[model samples]
Target: MKRTTLSIALLSTVMLLTGCGEESNQTSNTATTQSVEKEPAQKACYDVGETTSFERKDVTGPRCQWRSEHNFIVYSEDLSKPEYPGTLPVKPGYAVRRAKEWPREDLSDASSYDKPRIQFWWNNVSSRDPLVNDYENGYKIWSVKIDGTDLRLVTDDMPSTASPQTFMMSRSPNNRYVAYAYSYGEPLIKAIFDLKTQQTIQLGSARTKPYLVWADDSSYIYFSDGFKRYKYTLATGIKEEVDVPLSENTVIVDGKLINAAGLGVGVYDAKTLKRLYTILPEKEFEDSVDIEKRIYRQIAISPNGKYVWGINSYRKVLINVEDKTWLAFSKEGDEKKVYDKVVNISNNGRETQVGAAIITIKHYGSDYRYELTGKGRQSWKVIQSGQNTITPVLYNADANDGRFLEIENDE
Candidate 1:
């Protein structure tokens, strides 16, 4: 459905109603109760039929890493590979327009950000990109609210002709700037899209693989071309070199420099560049299996700073820093099934910053939800049953209706 695209000023400005006189405290309370009762509930996600609901493994308590059929799916996207070759929309520019109340429109290939409040993905059959296999011609970045409202184009035509590839794409923590890398020439073209200004600018080019990180302030960004680290300010258009020996895969999550490697996950203080946390591999598991042989991938920290997950091909470990507990399933060690998985932690609302971590795992054409018990234990339960259903708030923004990017090949 189409969004009521109000300007930033209009949306940000709070409307204050004036009256002849103020109401009494009791009357105000009554009015407030009525307003609260009458307000509409937050939108919920419904099945697009393309996705399904699967099983959830209840492997929680003392042990760690569910090394058997208890493994759940983990949904994640690689920023390095932004555009994947896929089928275009049949109608191309035809977007379904709807009011605030919506029907289950086909959100086939839609992909959502970690936040899930908004979704952004490239549209191949868009009116902007009318050519076939002419991916380089131009494409549009379509965005919509989680409730399927406020559907609008976030970026103008991103021409592949100018940028042979638009890789390493990410939205800023503030959601103020959207950055990506493209091939302009010998140097890699790195561009930023200002959501407020609705303008896209080529900050400059890099010689490296083009890994970018936005500062918490959103005023500056740090990126690595290869081994060289540089910072660019959005307001001043100034780029400065930082003498930090960082690599291309370095990412800034919640303002921390996250380095996920063979050593496990390392969370660093982005400003002082000090190591804040060095999450090592579980020693018990390390002793049982070969470090080089066992796979440890998709290392992510909960946004609430409560849990850290080391999603392995065979085993998965959940860590709570306060208690120093490495929790997982009941079983351990062995060749599990072909695990196509990506686990995400979210809140009740798509845009809420603080709340219980709604731990979701997608595997085998279905989804399962688990909760962290009050004692910091994992409480596994089937939140939804049936086909591939999403967390009602996520509007699929990709071409392949709700298809996730996960490969079980642990190498």
Candidate 2:
């Protein structure tokens, strides 16, 4: 069945009415209870099977489907590689949308920085099968430089699955190891791959596809299989059962886990798994609507780890990790404008303030870019506009030069 698309404003209005809200800089000592309601049956996802002619008016199907796997084209920005302006022509048949973070330009070692590498998932389909077949085939982790040289396979252990959407892969911060899993309908397998050692350490299978997160220091890996949490230490080669603030929808930054706890949000010590504080919606959302919308279902953390943002269907909250302050916004225009991503960039324009960092905000539709600094938010010009699912590569805050990898859904 075709996926349904809702306007951002309409979706935000629905979310604001049925979901919790967070604003200002206040936080709570504990989490509050808020019941969440599912969208009306008319908006739910359901299989239309071979009958593709029927429209939504005649069917009460799902608002969304289980997965919407699509082809991903690679793109990059490197002054050394002028060949890659829009899309980097990769040999892989299909690429995963989750492109691991590219390393910042290392002024110390200009050689390595000039040849930045990007790791992503690519399908290794068999020659016998149709080249453009569905995902129920094979996948392998691979990496290539911005100029398309040094193409190497990260791993080939990914299981053949009908549902590539269920697979999860995470690259460590230090760029040494990759934690990957094939969840499928049930938990199948999970493991860690050492890029240097070229060794695969199986972390054991999960009853469900487990969530994988790496510590800020790259010392340990935390994962939860819905029932219990486990921490895997890298140096000791030890896997121990431990309680962590890990959840299906949590991101760890600066040794802290930003957890989406029902209608509210929580910050916890990633190492100790102890709750540091709880962020609750303002009185307006908490008392106004008791229903939930799975607040903060998605999280994006800045490279510097100083800022993190949580996004639900339409509402989003940006939190300043160091100050413990936050700002809430939605697409409805009642609050601050919602931004989908936040990244740190050096303010090169001001040579005296070279050390100063500028926060770049990429809007949801990839239509506009904005820079948020201590003063306020302002427009940041960018070349790639009117395109959706555009991931920045070597993203420059000045808007003078940058590379964007665009993912177009192939129907």
Candidate 3:
């Protein structure tokens, strides 16, 4: 909801594939007349020049791990940090743009293992008012490295009258492709990008609530708009709706899907849409809670599609996909449950480690406890000190469960 000046390092000679510098650069670039049947030439990755230093925002935003090896931040501050006096990452957000309530940036590691990169969105619009950002245009998708070089712009060619907004991304298991969705006024902008070539293809649109899942080989892109699931074959360009029933709390893994409907957790074959396994909540908790009537939301699946975590307003469920096992547990009687969130996922999409935060708000202060849970052959939990509310709710859980990397320097 808020816009800010982004300070990225190493962009002295970065080529602008689709620039948004000048006020008039909002013109749609072949996005309107483009036909879905035609395939564009694969674009070589943005040609980046020498590395440069920057001194932009003083306050850093959330930091994301790229390939679980490097860090990228979406910071915002009052000052602008320039490398060569004029080179800036993006225009700075006006101090007046700050609002009491607005959505913060939600970034995902959209990097391909072969070519390290991270994906995030830019909302130039500061308000719902048409005048804030040209209501006709402005929103965009971007990718950069953990080292802050090779800043490439995706989501060009947006129709001038059509606003390409509300983007959700799902990187393929192979890490070569990212399939995402955005609505252009009507229908939907369901597209996939080949990170290597920097080329994106629009397959089709969705009418209802749309969720995306990519095939392991990057050969197919699947999306469900609540009613039915559709599979679009990359080679054939054929998009056919499949007979898949979906609720709001379901997510598709590579070859399987995890759904928390009825009174149990259901696993299905993604290809054949066949039920593979079902896990009911433990009998001890079943007496107090009605799984059949409970609505599970905020479901988070690990990058490898091996572990599934789901939560209703009050309860939580953890599912081990490989073994078809699950656990449904919640805090005991009258316990204060302030917040919970999934922080860091595995870099290589394994069950090695996943990070999360469990919080309890007290009269004096809030308690922030971080957890790094291990799944698969190795299983353990390394915890962070949760003495006070000052503890950051999110932890960048790498192989080390790095603590200092994101900690602010009080000195």
| Cα lDDT, model 2, residue 170 | 65
Clashing pairs in 2: 36-292, 43-63, 44-61, 44-62, 44-63, 45-62, 45-63, 46-62
TM-score of each: 0.49, 0.52, 0.50
lDDT of 1 by residue, 291-327 (tens): 7645565544433334455555456655554345565
Better of 1 and 2 by lDDT: 2
Q: Summarize candidate 3's per-residue lDDT along 1-411 as a digit string, tens digits.
A: 123223232242243432434323544434544543466542221101111214322332332112111112222222223222222223211111111122222234433122333444443233332224342124444443322233334444445344433324566655556666667667876778765565788766766666666665668767775367788887898989876655434556556776655444678887787988776654456667665446554555544455555566566666666766665555444332322433222332222122211211111111111122111111111111111111111112222332111111211
lDDT of 1 at 258: 63
Give the 10-residue window scoring lowest on summed lDDT in candidate 2: 350-359
* TM-score, ranked from best to worst: 2, 3, 1
Query: TM-score for model 2?
Result: 0.52
- The Cα RMSD of model 2 versus the native structure comes to 28.1
By TM-score, the best candidate is: 2
RMSD (Å) of each candidate, 1 decimal: 22.9, 28.1, 22.4
Model 1 weakest lDDT span, ten residues long: 348-357
Judge candidate 1 against the unseen true structure and give its global Cα lDDT, from 0 to 1: 0.42
Worst 10 residues of 3 by lDDT: 381-390
Candidates arranged by lDDT, highest first: 2, 1, 3
Instruction: Evaluate residue 243 in candidate 2 and report its C-alpha lDDT on the 0 to 100 scale.
Output: 64
Candidate 1's error at 218, in angstroms?
Answer: 1.4
Q: Any idea how many clashes model 3 has?
A: 5
